[model samples]
Target: MLQYIIKRLLVMVPTLLGVLTITFLVTQFIPGGPVDHMLAQLDGHGARSGADTGESATGGWSYSGRQGIDAAQIEQITALYGFDKPPLTRYWEMLKNYVRFELGDSYYHHQSVASLIQEKLGVTVSLGVWIFFLTYLVSVPLGVAKAVRAGSRFDTVTTLIVLVGYATPGFVLGILLIVLFGGGSFWDIFPLRGLTSDHWHELGWGGKILDYLWHITLPVVASVVSLFAMKTLLTKNMFLEEISRQYVLTARAKGLSERQVLWKHVFRNTLLPLITGFPATFIGAFFTGSLLIETLFSLDGLGLLSYEAINNRDYPVVLGTLYLFTLIGLLIKLLSDIAYLFVDPRIKFTAQES
Candidate 1:
């Protein structure tokens, strides 16, 4: 197992490089740079404020209007941001910095990307923990029961509910929930946006905890509502398939109870296929932070951060988030492979190149 882990870790080098290269190529090919995004934002703000003054909002000297940006202004912006160099050169510099864990400062935030991530990491981690718990806790037993009671009323009802949950969009669900329970004419039970109230700092420990959970309740439900169906159905089908296998029949024929045959013989093997996809669950929890939900809830998580970064062309934040996410995905893949050895001891790993 250790040897397999070591080999997989080594393999991650090239895989990571491939990911980085692709990311760099895509970002480079994008039409506008950070400066362009910044100018557009400023233009929109000026129009909204009805400030016809030739000066920028920041009181910085004016630029040529929507007609065109001047060469000197473009040159200054490029030089400041190191965009004057070739893409390959910029990539090399970024790679060097990333290797040292030195994610550069955000263009607008005036803080290092690492610091921003640190601030937001706890919220995402908490969200992930809840999501992971709910996903497995509810899905596993429900799935097994569905499989065991196949063709029964319970199975039919659950299947219909799962299908409906799967079909509904998460954002749609979130909106409905907010309208119904977040305040609507019904009794309000949760905060509309944010992880805490404005006076959170003044609250006692219990109040803080309660407030935090109250704010997160809707987002957590929204995050996992759509996820439950697929996992439950997958687990159910895997178990159903295993129940039909010869090994399970042999165990049953040997006079073992249905429970033992299912749990000891069938369920264990059923989990192998499910376990193979375990990393996807972790990946979804860790990196894919349900951008729409986060944005709608005004939560400060990686999803919203990435969304804002991309819109503003905050390259440091975007690249930092990308690198971190890709690294996480690779690590989870390695962990998933390691988990296999424990799940199925019969599985062996050889050091052969293949």
Candidate 2:
């Protein structure tokens, strides 16, 4: 197991490098980089100032216009943003900085990418935890019940409901939820936006908790409603498959109660596939799946931050977040394999298996 873990960790080095390299290359080739964005802003400002002064305004930095910005000024600005450096040299510098865990500063936020992430991490983590726990807590037992009662009215109704939910997009559900519950031409039960009320700091501890829960409820529901169909159906299908297996029949023939045969024999096997998937789902709780839900609720999370960074051409934040996400994904995959050993001891990890 230790050898397997070490090998996996080593493999992650190249994987991370490859992802980073591709991301860096894309950022380089993309139009409207930091340099061009800054220059465009300068040009707009120059155009306005020149027009006000009754001077002839060339589109970009002018040589002898009322706007003081010139070629030298442009060079200084470019150098300041490190656009003066060759792409390969910048890429090498990025690799070195990343090695020391320095994610660098955001282009516009005036803060380190690490600090920005730290600030936003809590919200995403909170949403993810709520979503992940609620999904399993509700889906697993519901699935088991459905499997046990297959072909019944209850199962048929639930199947239809889940299918409808699965067919609907999460953002669409978020909008519907906002309209119905979030003070939009309806009952107005939940707050329209934000993860907490404005007076959250003034509230008592219990009040604070309740307020937080209240604000999060709509967003969490919107995020997880679509997820339920997949998880619940998967659970139900796995359970149904195991129930039909010969071990379940043999357990029943051996005078075991139906409940005992299902829980003791079938439940363990059903859980293996689910457990195998736990790492991805569990890790995903930290890196949220839906930026739209966050946007709908005005929640400042990693998802929203990444979206904004991408749109604004904030390379540091974009690449920094990508690197961290990839690293976490690699580590979680390793952890998943380790979990399998504990979940089912019959599973073995050998060097030869690689």
Q: TM-scores of all models?
A: 0.87, 0.90
Error of 1 at 163 (Å): 0.5
Best by TM-score: 2
**Residue pairs of candidate 1 with colliding backbone atoms:** none
Q: What would the per-residue lDDT of candidate 1 be over residues 1-354, giving only the tens digit for each residue? A: 777778888988788788778878887777666766555555553243325645544322333444455677767876777789988899999999989989899986889999999988877887788887888889988999999999999999999998898898878888888887888767688887788899999999999999899899998888887788988999999999988889887887899999899888888887887777778988786667468877778788888778777766788898898888888888887778777778788887874576
Each model's lDDT comes to 0.81, 0.84
Candidate 2 local lDDT, 1-354, one digit each (tens): 788788888999999999999999999887767766666566664346556646444222222332555889788877987889999999999999999999999987889999999999988888888988998999899999999999999999999999999899888998998889888778799996688999999999999999999998998888888878878988999999999999888999999998899888888888888777776687656675668878788888899899878765789999999999999888877887887877688887874554
Native-to-model Cα distance after best TM-score fit, residue 156 in candidate 1, in Å: 0.3
Which residue runs does candidate 1 get wrong by more than 4 Å? Answer: 39-73, 201-205, 253-255, 351-354
Q: Where does the lowest 10-residue lDDT sum fall in candidate 2?
A: 57-66
Candidate 2 Cα errors over 4 Å, as ranges = 45-69, 283-288, 351-354
